[model samples]
Target: MNKIFIIEDDVRIREELSTFLNRYGYESLFSINFENIIEEALKEKPSIILLDINLPYFDGYYICREIRKHSDVPIIVVTSRDSDMDELMSINLGADDFITKPYNTQILLARISSILKRVYGVSRGEILEYRGIIYNMAMSEVTFNNNSLELTKNESRILNILINNNGKIVSRDEIMKTLWQEAEFVDDNTLTVNVNRLRRKLEDLGAINYIQTKRGQGYILI
Candidate 1:
């Protein structure tokens, strides 16, 4: 499995995406310590990196530049900001690919897959199924009980992540990562709001009470 490094401060995005990537056969590691971001990444020696422009300490561009000086690891910029200048700056700093924040899991996966294939000749793909549900990677959709839910990209991603870890508790941080996507921004508490919405939607679709919250611990699929 190819080791993919992630540099995002949003723990929700970092860990959830890491889980998704891992399920697809890539070893994903997100930076928890930002004190020596570059040093930590270099030490890990990842095949590729998903970098975010807005990081904890030093921004991604500076780190990308520093990394480029030593290694040619493929760097994909994942930024919340959308501007020509930002994209141009990322390219100038030696980033291989750039993606705007709250991106679709399919889009992100495709980018990583493409970059990995080109760089390391390795590709990762997944077709997730649990109970009666299907997570179609190509379409970024969920199919359950022969009924298709054209979910928002984040919803599909959150559902897929949860189902992949079936019978286990997934924290609010994990499920809520989906709400932070797009140009619209939702705060931390909004994760719970989104999960409640997702739960209702799932129930409305004729599914049982699949998700249950465990107070301070997290939510579990029961």
Candidate 2:
């Protein structure tokens, strides 16, 4: 069963969301201690997260950004704020989707399922190995010679696609499309920055020539 972490401070909203998710066969972990939302999320390792914009101690954007530092788990912003700015901000913070308050349960469920399918199901393959480097899609982690390589969310996603399509060129357009599918916008340089950061991490892990950039083409795992 997929685990879902809810980080809403409203007890009523949290319980309602949890119960609704449970009906859809999802195991929900509602956040009680707002001060330790990240700790709980790390401990639970949820498949998806439902976050609210108005949190108690810390805001949802902060939590989402923090989580994106290490994990690429699907996050759906469920909040009362209906502003387009809020939605865009959530996406900018790395949320997979957004749902406003008073949302239809059926629509929410559909969105959740769609995001999960696109994220964890389609983009990922089995554990990928290349040049003694191990990239585990399920765990969203990489290891080299038994030493784990810490990766950010974007780094992990980039490595996941490249390593899974080993020896094949992955178009930059394709990557940008995937990353921006949840939102209407993505900065032109965001993908470039992520690729550079990922390459640096790989180099630090003693892996060279892993990601080869093709001029006027794309990137390939070599």
Candidate 3:
């Protein structure tokens, strides 16, 4: 799972963001020590950051600039400062994205997903490892022990979501939405077929019962 470092001083907002992100399978990390914010962030080595402008000690812009000097981690400025200048300054100081306060949480999720995809999805041979199975996303293949099986596009996506969320029960709706993000119509039966095929492929590689269905809920990767 990806770790998101939050730099908001408001305790309630920080806790809320952490809970929301956690529900979506992300690990959230934060600190109340505003004085060593930069150092703490660098040490944590988070996949991304959610920064607040109105902070104690040093503001977010300075932290963003200083962090930029050391690392290229994606930063999204989330603050109440809705002025054009705030957005522009955030961009100028190396923020990858900006969102004003009282924002829609769904939009925030989308922006974070977009930035993460852009930053991490460009590698030539990206692979996800879980429970001794290696999923080579670039080549659409899953390897276990010495056996390997090729997967179709739909099967690959379904497996990707399951493996990313690992032990969690991923809803059928969420899987369909990810598989067909731009489609006007989605067939429920199609997802079942793809998931069944993926499970069969895993079985072929000796990964028996890797995916378990939770009755009317969804599927979990065990």
Error of 1 at 21 (Å): 0.8
Best by TM-score: 1
lDDT of 3 by residue, 1-222 (tens): 788999999999999999988866678999999999999988999999999999999999999999999999999999999999999999999999999999766556657776777898632235566776777676688887657889999999989999989999999888988999853498788889999999999998899999999988999999
For residues 138-205, write the lDDT of model 2, one tens digit per residue: 55667765566667777888887887688999998888776667433777678889999888878887
Question: Relative to the true structure, how large is the alpha-carbon lDDT of every model?
Answer: 0.78, 0.80, 0.88
Q: What is the lDDT of residue 2 in candidate 3?
A: 87
TM-score per model over all chains: 0.58, 0.54, 0.57
List runs of model 2 lying over 4 Å from the truth: 122-222
Best by lDDT: 3
Q: Cα RMSD for candidate 1? A: 16.5
Candidate 3 lDDT trough over 10 residues, lowest sum: 121-130
RMSD of each: 16.5, 17.6, 14.6
Sequence-dependent TM-score of model 2: 0.54
Global CA lDDT computed for model 1 = 0.78
